[model samples]
Target: MAVAAAQELDELCYLSAQAMGSLTVSEHFHVIKLLGEGSYGKVMLAVHRKRGSPMALKFFPRESTTLASFLREYNLSLSYCTHPSLTRALGIFFSTPDYYVFAQQAGLYGDLYSVIVSEEGMEEERIQRVMAQLSGAVTHLHSLGFVHRDIKPENIFLCDSSCRWVKLGDFGLARAVGSTVRAVWYESPFCTPEVGPAKEAEKEWERRQEEGTEEEMEDTWITVEPGIDSWALGMLTYCLLTGCFPWEESTHDDRRYRKYEEWFEIERAHDKTDCYAIMEERYRENPPPSQFHGIGSLAMALFKELLNPEPKQRGSPEEILSYLGGPWLLGSEREQRRRAQEAQKEAQKVSETGGLKDELLREGKGER
Candidate 1:
């Protein structure tokens, strides 16, 4: 049958790919089909030859980047390896001049974006489970002093079994707490614009260029806080519940940016637009979750808090966990509050410390 022939060809491709370059399939891992491909690399599904456990192998081009860059990303990804709601990075392998491979635990059910699109309608319980898993993953990342930077549905995967454990993966853009240069659109609105050299800076550079005295542009960057991740989380929740992007305009409105801008201005002028009012007026502001046949007010509230434009006002992961009635809610909230108190104490201690030993003494007292 045609299906049988296709399967055979797929097997051949998998075997050949596993053997490509420096990778060997000995008795450890048997490569399956390609899982997905992105701008930087590709992910392939492989099963442990002896144990039969599935895993993912991501291949990146080492020649295209420096060792420092690879090491930074590797270390950041490693920090979350122990989180149950996150995909585990197994190891990194360098086989050929063209490839830098990263192996990780595989997800059986693929990404949430594809799953939701295929199923058409996800049950309320399923949606909550996915959100809770995502919240936990994000919270863990924040606690570890890192930002995922990208939290879209395509990056979230599900396990194979009936339980469908959600796992947050794909850390290619993740960075340390203070690093900026976040992916466009996903950047927090509260963060300053990622504009190039200011007009004055550019003009000065031009004048210096004519005189051949121009200094190289210093690498200026911004600092994004955990609040930005919370905003993207809101957007993802909205998309999952509505099956459409929060800012995407409907065809009936011609889906034009100009129209969207106009509507945004109107909404800004009058803050009294109800859910129905916004949906009917702009057609770009997505319909409320309550408008969705199966979704309810709790879902709507979650989305609203997540997407609030003000960064300081955005809900913390602890707050979100509490809102969802997650098991970790109470403990996480207490931990967050404790950390805040400790931070305030540390700040006060620093103010009183005239020298390094004073700071150390304060820390010693706290430890005791």
Candidate 2:
């Protein structure tokens, strides 16, 4: 996507912010610029009028989100955003007649999706640091009994372009339920079999529509598990390693995923079946099957754990820590990148002990 120039972006951001009712908002904040906007609403860069501190103001339109749903999301943001690797929401939430608004520490570098697109892919060592932070954040959220249902590239924000500071954001789809029944309209790449079959789930969802259900449900009831986030983490790691996706979606309807699923099924029965070999023989002329080429053996091993078709067999997000000690890039790329990153860090080391959680807390209490 083409990024607008600084002047044009500022002008465009001001124009977008002008469309919303600004009386209450302007009283609290001076809109600095528009960060990003989507179907949900706009996220604006603003500064507190009284404190003069920067914040990212997220606005959810009433037409798109209900009061209950919006409040649920806001509450979850307040409850769990405290994790350093989780985007920290300011202790502020209020509603306008047309919007539900909240504040967060400004993610100056934008989201992970933009980074993946711009940088092509990341180095193995950086991926390690990123996954380390994310795994910790996922574990933190799950430990509190909440699942970040939507853990995708777009929702993972970057505080630094190099991904040294990344956080998981967007809790609109998060649910704390022991089990949930949602209406699935489309196949999602991050979901696995135990999340339930997409075709069957869609039928149930459609039945709800046929019955004139007022609120659209998105999935069929299934017990919540860490596999949900683990599967997504796999997808995130895949994108970080390879700029492209292994499949369009995880459903059988997707040809690429079907090929992968078939291989995985056989892989279960024959533990000796090498995925890399299958890629070489089957798609020899087709850029190799499953995009498994060029990745390290250890990474392929990790992928099997994260992308296991069966959710019951899927690895937890915390399992990523086990692989951190090993190489994830093929050949000498891992050592090369690792040493370069170390040298880069040696110049100016950033302390990891006091992170955003403490900083945000102090800021909230007016102690910073």
Candidate 3:
């Protein structure tokens, strides 16, 4: 939770060509240092000289036909930027045919992945802060009709003096309702395999007919829902608490059908002595967070609700906000009285104005 010295921070800065060369954005910004790289492109710590604040500039190479998608993602991120736990997408600029630029407020402390790996474990209070922040951010995103799709530790960052602020980043895989694109590895457990060409569909149908029985067929396929995010979140919470993954390498040699079976056996056999054991049991049969030691009870409760295997059983963002004590839903319990007053005020304002603005200023409209 302590701030690293300037020299120490400087040592952590990585340099690469992606961070060195000038990015082709509509407007110019000083590229300071490379923050990190990903499958799509590199993110750099940049400074808008005129604005006088550090920003993260993500550059996407134009060869992959992902320009339009990346632009849409960036624009979507901007709409949810006001939440304390969410990163703010300032603006996006595309200057050339081969590059796309995404600008965001820079976090002084790095990502949760590096932080957890470096510190080994975070304090309970810090962990609770992070969960509360993430819960708020996710709730806000859901309210705006978006799902992060990818919710790994690497995509969460910390800012401010005590590294208390948590921001969800990397919107490239985020999806709105009706979006067909899916994020690999972060795929929902319920996701069905993508149907390919006509021949492929025919083959799949034949395979299904061969399998027979609804139960047997369901076992052979997967479906995805918001619950998948919950599962990933549970994995993350376990990593934060135990400093390891629940499904560590098993001794079995089965690489295909039998691998998961072998791993599940191992998971079942592990003695409930350490944090890992608790995690394993929770993965198998979720227990309330209050049962866990050294972790915030509220956070664990939220985790249980989020990671419920049954998508229908999983908690909604509003429910999560309540569990985290979010301010949006707090106040007096006289619901209908407050609602009536608010409705009257809205009616008065509408009568005064004739109607709502015909053209609402949609935020985050441009591409990065």
Worst 10-residue lDDT window, candidate 3: 1-10
Who wins the lDDT comparison? 2
List the candidate numbers ranked by TM-score, top first: 2, 1, 3
The better candidate by lDDT, 1 or 3, is 1
Q: lDDT tens digits, residues 130-241, model 2?
A: 8999999998887777778788888888888788989898887776535454535356677665644656667777888889987665545566666778899998898888
Model 1 vs. true fold: TM: 0.60
Write the residue-wise lDDT of candidate 3 on 1-368 in tens digits. 01122122223222211243434442567778888788878888987877767788877887863645665656666655578778877854543567667688777678888867532455544665677677777777665656676787878887854557878888776655444442232122222112112234445667887888353312122233455455556556656655654343211221321343343344445442345325534554633222233344344445445544345566655454454432111121235348878999999998766543432323234321
Assess every candidate by TM-score.
Answer: 0.60, 0.73, 0.58
Predictions in order: lDDT: 0.58, 0.73, 0.55
Name the lDDT value of residue 171 in candidate 3.
75
Better of 2 and 3 by lDDT: 2
TM-score of 3: 0.58
lDDT of 3 at 168: 86
Q: Alpha carbon lDDT of residue 214, candidate 1?
A: 48
Report residue 342 deviation for candidate 3 (angstroms): 50
Q: What TM-score would candidate 2 get against the native?
A: 0.73
